[model samples]
Target: MNKLVTFIGNGNMALSIAKGLKNNYDIEVVGRNIEKLNKFEEELGVKVQKHLMDNFDISNKTIIFCVKPANVECVSERLEGKARVVFSVLAGTTIKKLRDNLNPEGVVRCMPNLAASVGESMTTLTGDEEYKKEAQELLGAIGPTRWLASEKELDIATALAGSGPAYLALIAEALADGAVKQGLKRDDAMAIMRGLFGGFGKLIQEIHPALLKDGVMSPGGTTAAGYGALEDGNVRSACIDAINKAYKKAVELS
Candidate 1:
């Protein structure tokens, strides 16, 4: 028999997981929003039942707490001793915290980003040895799942893959804005910026940084001028600072 995966929220992450697992597993969503639940049911062709805050059946099911960090413990308490496996996607809530709250034999902490919607998410999974294999299989249904030996690495993964898409989107928007300021039409600027982003990914795939930079510099070419400007603007420092700030925030939440 297929394992039933029950999501406790109707939010984007929950929807993404449901979409990913709908075809392969028996997935059910229980949340407060009836309209959203109905829409998801119609779209995904799965069972979506309305769930009151205090009334939910979790026994024999993998209960996924997709609620906000503040509400994770509350939901966990309600599902305690009822779920076979309790998985949490709430950021800043560590495995220790989850274990303390849920007190389940199978408690897994996972961090999946927005890219899961496209099946390209970088998800990090960590938990007890007994559930590691099961957790990987469950999350792998959505995207690539890497099991970290140390649970603390989830914070770093959260900083990188969890919040990474927003940072990349901000970079894309800024690049497009710069192109627009240079007199390109908004659509045209976005098109070019999108291609440039793809090109950067390809370049990274094909060659090492030292060789790629040497090839691009070409003894004082336009590429060299652009690189010089980026260096002068302290762009590297800004990027590191952004990641550091996000990591600190994750620690604070934990």
Candidate 2:
């Protein structure tokens, strides 16, 4: 590609996006320190042009804006030159804030999970009307993307898809722990848990969660018994609360 995509940070989020787009674009990274930038390159296994924030030039460069929401203002003060376009992955940060602070020609607010590192993220994006399609296609290089009509909608998606992987990982680990507590070998329990999640990942795409659960939970069986236990333990309520709390946090951050 002729255009260089300059990532504005060297953290996990930046690394993940860079990993997905490395083959398709010319990559350059900007960070505060040379050692961290070199570490990023080593981890990414792609030698990219690097620049310090004080010396980096943003004019006309496409930016993968990956700084934390809390640090956005401080980072914005350090940046100079007009960015051609910026695709930001800061959850709870708005396009208006980005424009007022970073002063990009166009800003696309996005929420992409860590799964981007493995090319399986569910990225949600919303931005300037003209850049909507371009943003989708660019993020689609890593995984499928959904373009939302409004920032509020994108905020809800962030609470769900952006925070989803961590929730799922907790369940996976807990499931393995359950097996280990029930006398299964730790290694075997972990292996089985991973396999179960992998298979369920494929199955869920085809069947609704409720329908799939109903199909497995025959009357008076092991599945039913376990389901009953989960119900009694208020698992569903806890999950609902998780989403509510996360969504509230997103709103508060905004």
Candidate 3:
């Protein structure tokens, strides 16, 4: 029989995974929003199951908990003894908490960024070795999955990948604004910024990040001037501070 993959929420992250797995597995999306769920079912051509907060059977399927961190314990309690493997995308909810709350055969914690919508997400997976194969099989359907032996690393991954996209978007927006400041049209500026960052991404993928920076920092060039300005503005320090703040918030929420 094909493995049944059941999603516990109909949020954006849940929708992304469901869409990604549409062709590879038997997927079901369960939630209280019947109208929205039905819409997604028709859009993705997948099964939609109604889920009430108080009653649901999760035992026979691999349950993906896509709810918020604060609501995970409540949902897990309702699914106790039903879900074989409980996979969670809730940030900062540790494996220990999940095990104690859900008491599933296995608990897998994952951090997948917004890029999952495009099947280009950088996802981090951490759980027991015995269940690693099954966890990988499920998450691999959404994007490239990497196993982190230490569960604590998921916290770092949360800050980096889970929250990284917003940081990149902020940079892109700032770049566009800078172009506008230089008297370019908004649409043209945004297009140019997109191409520049797209090429920068390709460069990082093809070469070492450090080497790419060195390559651009030619002696007495415009790139060097821009780099100098960034250093003067303490851009690196600001980025470090931002990540630190995000990590601290995750810890607090966990």
Best by lDDT: 2
- Judging by TM-score, tell me the better candidate of 1 and 2: 2
Please write out the lDDT profile of model 2 over residues 1-254, one tens digit for every residue: 23578999999989988888888888999999999999999999978998999846688888889988998999888888999899999989988899999898999998999889899999999999888888887898879899999998988888789999999999899889998999999999999998999999999999999999999988899999988888999999998989888988898898
Q: Score each candidate by Cα lDDT.
A: 0.80, 0.90, 0.81
The lDDT, on a scale of 0 to 1, for candidate 2 is 0.90
- The stretch of ten residues in a row with the least summed lDDT in candidate 1 is 48-57
Please give, for residues 100-178, the per-residue lDDT of candidate 3 as tens digits. 8777778889889998888878889998777788877777877788899876687877888889999999989987998
Sort order, TM-score high to low: 2, 3, 1
- Candidate 2: residue pairs that collide: none
TM-score of each: 0.90, 0.96, 0.93
TM-score of 1: 0.90
Best by TM-score: 2
User: Given candidate 3, what's the lDDT at residue 135?
Assistant: 78
**Clash pairs of candidate 3?**
59-82, 59-83
Q: Give a tens-digit lDDT track for model 1, residues 1-254.
A: 24777888878888888888877777778776678778767877666555654666677777777888898767765653466777888898887777677665578889999988987678998877788888888888788888887766888878888999998998899879977988999999988988988798779768997898888787668888878888999988988888888888999999
Which 10 consecutive residues of model 2 have the lowest summed lDDT?
1-10
Clashes of 3: 2
